[model samples]
Target: MNRKQEETETPSKYMNQMIRQQQKQLLRLLRKAGVMPDERIEVRDSELLIGLFSQIRRLPEFAEDKKKAAMLMHAMDTIFKFPVSRATVQKIYYRNKDF
Candidate 1:
């Protein structure tokens, strides 16, 4: 390709500026919800929490109570910290001791 075409193929400064603007827009949308600042989200009732805890108890994979507690704690942290991701979940699962 010619020099002019090559320059156009590369992302221009204006393109970078536009990308930043879009990212800011997304952040603004998230801020409108109560989720961005790591606020404690209240559940409906004690029963709900109990149900959740019970469901966790039924999972067959955790070999010990400590590991189960660690995994559950990691899951809760992930649910609050940012958007959920499988890789992030796995990372938290393995890194539970550090938390």
Candidate 2:
């Protein structure tokens, strides 16, 4: 990539790509080990969580009901553990999704 491209890319965007590459490698390793890749979610990928939330947010049920918003919040709480702050999740959750 050129310097202009590198300068334009957001850190989170770059991180997401790296995380995806790692996940692909893990899947390959799992296959080599005769493990069921679908049965495991070893790493918590924030990009994925955000994508799920985005899709759920698009749902008419979730969009029209305040109570349904609680479900997404609860899912976020369950998704992140200690050392990963609510602020961190919020930062990622609220960041621009242009990429």
Candidate 3:
């Protein structure tokens, strides 16, 4: 309603949108990589997420665009502990020719 209120609301809304975008990107990355976990993953803490990110970050083929996809997955894993399935990763491979 007021100028200050509008400014505050805008940032909050933007941040929320950014968070949602990150989550969506993460899910898409996992789907592309065939890493959807069978069971729902519970987020314990940032440590587990850091570890997961490290794991994917070390993948040899994960460079350039692939690296971006991996980073998105890592963020999702860290924020929400999303589980990835190997089968899903394989499916993604076939879906994309460059992969």
| Per-prediction tally of clashes | 0, 0, 9
Residue-level lDDT tens digits of model 3 in 1-99: 458868776556667799889988997888778897434456445344545554554456564457575566644544453344534433433243331
Residue-by-residue lDDT tens digits, candidate 1, 10-81: 666777699979977776778788557546454434334434544564457654566686667555643543
TM-score preference between candidates 2 and 3, better one: 2
Q: Choose 1 or 3, whichever is better by TM-score.
A: 1
lDDT of each: 0.55, 0.63, 0.54
Model 3 ranges off by over 4 Å: 1-40, 64-67, 74-99
For model 2, residues 1-99, the per-residue Cα lDDT tens digits are 557767987456678799879978987898788884344233466666665676666569877985676668656655455245677765655554632
Clashing residue pairs, candidate 2?
A: none
Question: Backbone clash tally for model 2?
Answer: 0
Error of 1 at 10 (Å): 51
Which residue pairs in model 3 clash with each other?
A: 33-89, 34-88, 34-89, 35-84, 35-85, 36-84, 36-85, 37-83, 37-84
